[model samples]
Target: MSEENNIPSNAPVFQIQRMYLKDLSLEQPNAPQILLEQTQPQVDINLALSAEPVAEGVFEVCVTGTVTTKVGERTLFLIEAKQAGIFEIRNVPQEQVEGILGIVCPQMIYPYLRAIVSDVCTRAGFPPVLLTEVNFQAMFEAQQAQREAAASPTLN
Candidate 1:
């Protein structure tokens, strides 16, 4: 084995490259009527996670969420959120980048994203929303396996 291999290269190194809002939108369908009617608007929320490679050793992990509300047949509001974090990812093997992005980076970015989503909703005159933790490692591995499976067809 070469010195590089003998030295155990998988050391831990992670950095925050940047953080920004990739997208955001808010809408109130029945602006005047919804504002007047106050009957605890029904709320529904959904969330998703994603990551993209930006540079050789940098990747961005994003969490997006949508909130929908209705007050007795009239749309009260719609709030969408996209919070992203730029991560400086080095020392990890190329084969493991997806794992890092899917699993580790999401873990790091989730809190900030949750806070952003909650804060935004609160500022928009709604209660704060606390999103649940995501299983990025599992999601990453599943995606990797899918890609590998796609690349190499098998005989069933």
Candidate 2:
């Protein structure tokens, strides 16, 4: 038992402390008039991910999605949902931490954001808008590429 005391723990630790809806908003400018339209409304979705360090080993990640449905020039319904999670990331390399926060954390919280958007649209008297699966890895790669390009000097 005395020999075990000499050993040190170097295992990585990552956990979600809590997940909650940080913000939500629903707007129906056309309302009854828009509902009367016989044509199918077009939907446009926008997504964003953000991370902030709250404590020494704790971070907050937010996944935000906005859905807008329009019938011609008029608006049918617009809903925005923000889902956030508090994560504890310790014993991890500093360089890898950014990727974990950008890709892994957002992937974990995106489903909840999608559900909220669908539920809000359905409850507001519209068909449930099923959100497609997002590729966080690709997004992260693109952002990194853009940063690298910006930092490099233009030859022209």
Candidate 3:
């Protein structure tokens, strides 16, 4: 019982120190002319997530979203938003940390990215572009599968 009391604390700790918009850009190349067109432009959106260790127990996670709208051959507008957070995670097993960063961190930052994208589009004088919800677990699993496949040998 006494030895148990002497053991150092290894309790898990996870916290978000801060969340911020690291970068934002909007481009409207065909501004006035494109605005006059009555036809709706087709919208395309892409997303990516990354995490890196900033300190011994702190990490920086970022989710980047890009949106492009085009009417026929002309480009109506384009926007890219990168949302980031500083997270402090300690005492978690090494194997689990990757999952937490890949899934949980992206899940937390995605909403902010979506909102920023919508707001940027609306403020640029076009209709708001709503981003669809993402399933990070499925994405992570797919990425893992691809990595494994690339590493495995292919039979001729």
For each candidate, what is the lDDT?
Answer: 0.78, 0.91, 0.91
The TM-score values for the models, in the order shown, are: 0.72, 0.92, 0.92
lDDT of 3 by residue, 1-156 (tens): 237666456778789999999999999898787788899788888998889999999999999998988999898899999999999999999878989999999999999998999899788876789999999999999998999999999999
Give the 10-residue window scoring lowest on summed lDDT in candidate 2. 1-10
What RMSD does model 1 have? 4.8
Model 2 per-residue lDDT tens digits across residues 42-153: 8999998899999998999999998888888888888989999999999899978999999999999998988898899789887899999999999999999999999999
**lDDT score for residue 81 of model 3:** 96
Window of ten residues with lowest summed lDDT in model 1: 1-10
Provide the lDDT at 143 for model 2: 98
* TM-score for candidate 3: 0.92
lDDT of 3: 0.91
